[model samples]
Target: MGDDLNNDEGQLPRRDLLKSAGVALLAGAAASAGAAAAQTSASAPAPAPAARSGKAVGARLQGVQHFGLTVQNMDRAFEFYTEVLGGNEVMRDGDFRGEKIHNTLLTDQEIVARERGVNPRTIGVPDLKDGGQRLDVRFVQFDNVVIELLQYRDAQQPMGSGDSWAEPRDHMSPAYPRSMHICFYIRDDVDFNTFIRDLEAESARRGMTQVKANRVITVTSEQERQAAPLDANTNRITEGKSNGWSLIYCKGPEGEQLEFVQALGPVKKTFEDAMAARRRMLAAAGG
Candidate 1:
């Protein structure tokens, strides 16, 4: 839902940056997944006399319904998303039809960020060439997912992105891959340490160490829950060990790493498919 802030990266609203350091709000990295083997063609009725390898590939995908983020400040991300993550305001665009949808999404982000290695001289930005000037694109919603909050205020802004802890980043680094986070689940009778003491009282009322959270993470494997990708569910776990889901992580005011989830029981079952286990580890690493 945050799709790591719907594909987080940050900036173009200038100065003060930091939206990277692994996970930008993702509760148990959004619920510990175990769900697989459910749809036998929607109810075990139609596929009885099936045609073998002729059709039925897959892509009726229904999960992860929203994600997108580009923030550097749209009024401090609309006051930290409608006052500390309540999030709702499902609309708010800007001029030039938001720069023609921000240059048609920077032409699909210069072709899907060039296979995750990204180019354009390590994002030196320049109106991203022909597309970039939304300056303020909003769209928020929490529960069923949906997030889009860009700023790109006249481009040019990306270089070590401020919030300096010097060098810390860790959702295993490599600059957080899976299109970025948003896992906010927390509802199985709340009170996960009083939600990190109200996220350290909102990072001490925004003296802002990027609003805090980070501690609870417990996977307990099936190849580390199919190691995320193919629209990551971040390996759902919690069927035991006093139940599952449990997670914590926070940071927004630009350091942007969020997640605050809790399940504590019930949610299990997996036959381990996860996109054929990530295509058998990308065909045994021959990729």
Candidate 2:
């Protein structure tokens, strides 16, 4: 969730690029043409209860399965996530699926990147064996959530196209605000306050800049509105209804804009949750 990547304008910071790529990976895995076709063949009829009150819609995204990020050094990133953020190491290896994968875990770059649209072979080098360019990957689990850490060995590689920093003119993309960020949800405002305090304290201890922290409420499109809703007045929702989530925005060590979000409600929960739910419904309906 946190790393030492740069945050700068005009170009997608390496860390943000990695995280975004990771999400893309997860998306792809769930929606690939082959996966969709398989689901269509094995499709089953929905229970009447699940079809009625819509609770079935909410049952899909039960836990934080996994998340991916790119870092500068695998060893340092692995140590920081495990030691600093309190994640447990799960796996380490090389050449996953003959695609030159270096590390494999419940939460790894492959999982993250597949969620988006990027192919791992396009961005991941796997084991330094391919011209000594390997993506340092780590899978860490905290309770039910799985976090994947990815560090591409080559620093000079181009980030990607859909990235905000990499494509500023694409206001249609999420990173257009210059400070593209994501948020995670905590139990309540009390938990929110504690997280801020802890984050600041950690930042100070690490000699990192404590970036400004504030809240902003903005109107979203109908499609966007449906995915992550906000209360009209306070612009905040309950965590359970919204899926225990919140937001943490800060600059990584390399000056890359980063966002850690915790979900709390307005119709659907986290972006991933909502998307997954939609996919499930669509798959069930034979779409």
Candidate 3:
């Protein structure tokens, strides 16, 4: 079955690669953490959650639920995400039509994407040509939004230049300027900092180069601000206006871009907050 799906012209056996890499990456992370803790300060304080302000601007996101991507080597990618990045394999199954598929979930601080009445099929998967590769998606929940890793399997598949999976470099891709990168909000700055350090160490251990530190700026419109308070401030905006969002970008194992963000202020903390507000409005209207 795997070969049938993968061997087709232009078809890149990405899903299979993702599954293999996910398992190996997670295993490596667990082992590394244990060994590092044993050597490092065992007395280090337990990580703490960030403080939140009680201002209701709009809704809060639950964090990233799921995403899809393509990959070259499932086994290598699996090890990078699972062992090096600390993601656990939640379940393995086929897609909606019972097509064989692999699903893995990672712990993030919050959820980001919501069902904004968009058709799932439209945003769900891309229509690729025969043997064309689909987006290799990986999910990670964080404090503010879900972090998704997207890798294209077929080298011919045009991911913008410098993307994680662009040809030439198999594992690391040059960080592109102003590209769409997934951002993850963390609760405590301390924990967030530690997570970055861990990622850096993991990259070093795997002999991958860490890219220069660059921040991504986003602007939010007033309407968008009212809808998703968390992201509004982070969105790229004109100077003098509040740039609702800010993100520190990094790369995970196998060169997948990762973003760690700090909420602009009060509005973008929890996904539950957004849902609660909607419920309250609906109740007032007697819905």
Candidate 4:
């Protein structure tokens, strides 16, 4: 995150590349959306139910346990997530395959059997007991959130025969449907621009190709925030005038999208303040 990095004009700057890539990606997504819209209904669908029931059912639910990802290599993913990003290694397991796995994962035994020309019960299991499914897994934690990384012996178009594991897909784009990226919070004490420059250097040293915006962006005006092409919920979190937010998007070791955000004011505080206000209201109501 250095100002001097931008001054170097000998070659194309990383930020320029990032901006180009972002523009291309957004343009492609827009074109794809336009083509899709021509074939579909214009109106948006109704919002999904927030809970299964009105009161008691919703109250029983807790927060998310973890987010799961099927990765190509477990060790590589572990290194990128924990070593590079400073996540805590929580738990790990290996060679997850069995009849119980089939049931728990809801494997389509018949379909797998037909595709492989094998018995439904013995698809992945060589001894003909359970489908011979196998996978390696690890869990990494960032504060309260846990990310479960898995390397599954692919169910379809598997790379290896018998005991060997299959290779995962080679490429993914943020514009692709179902593609996702995770954002990490930068402490308020850290200078966002400097942190980004350092992050770029460190990641490059570790053989990652950075795709970051040229500069840290902060919304300075309410009109700019309102004009942002974002949904309402996201706007509240990232685009408000009092938020004092700056962010940059980049890529992980395997080209997976990643984001870093620094907030000078009021993002988390908004939530904390609301909770405090609720407590006061409840106290006043004698509840």
Top candidate, metric lDDT: 4
Question: Which is better, 1 or 2, measured by lDDT?
Answer: 1
Per-model TM-score on C-alpha atoms: 0.28, 0.41, 0.38, 0.55
Model 1, span 186-278: residue lDDT tens? 544434565455544554565555664443343465344334232232234555543565565556666666675554434311212343454
Between 1 and 3, whose TM-score is larger?
3
* Candidate models: Cα lDDT each: 0.46, 0.45, 0.39, 0.52
| Shift in Å, residue 44, candidate 1 | 28
Residue 100 of model 3 has an lDDT of 31
TM-score, predicted candidate 2 vs. hidden true structure: 0.41
Q: Name the runs in model 3 displaced over 4 angstroms.
A: 1-65, 93-179, 189-194, 210-246, 264-275, 282-287
Segments in model 1 whose C-alpha atoms lie over 4 Å from true places = 1-67, 73-181, 184-191, 209-259, 267-287
Q: Model 3 compared with the native: what TM-score? A: 0.38
TM accuracy, model 4: 0.55
lDDT of 2 by residue, 110-184 (tens): 677788778665544243434344343568755444667655444234322112112112232345664343333
Mark the 10 consecutive residues where model 1 has the least summed lDDT: 11-20
lDDT tens per residue, model 4, 1-287: 11223313222133222232234334434544554464456575432476334435533334357788766555566666765566668888766567666555645655677888986545433221253546667888765467887665644423322223434345666777888887766554544555555555555656555333333235566455334432221212346655666666776655567777654456556644654564454334322
In candidate 2, how many Å is residue 113 off?
A: 20
Q: Which candidate number would show the highest TM-score if scored against the true structure?
A: 4
lDDT of 3 by residue, 89-158 (tens): 5533211111232122211111212345543223333223233344445543322223344454444544
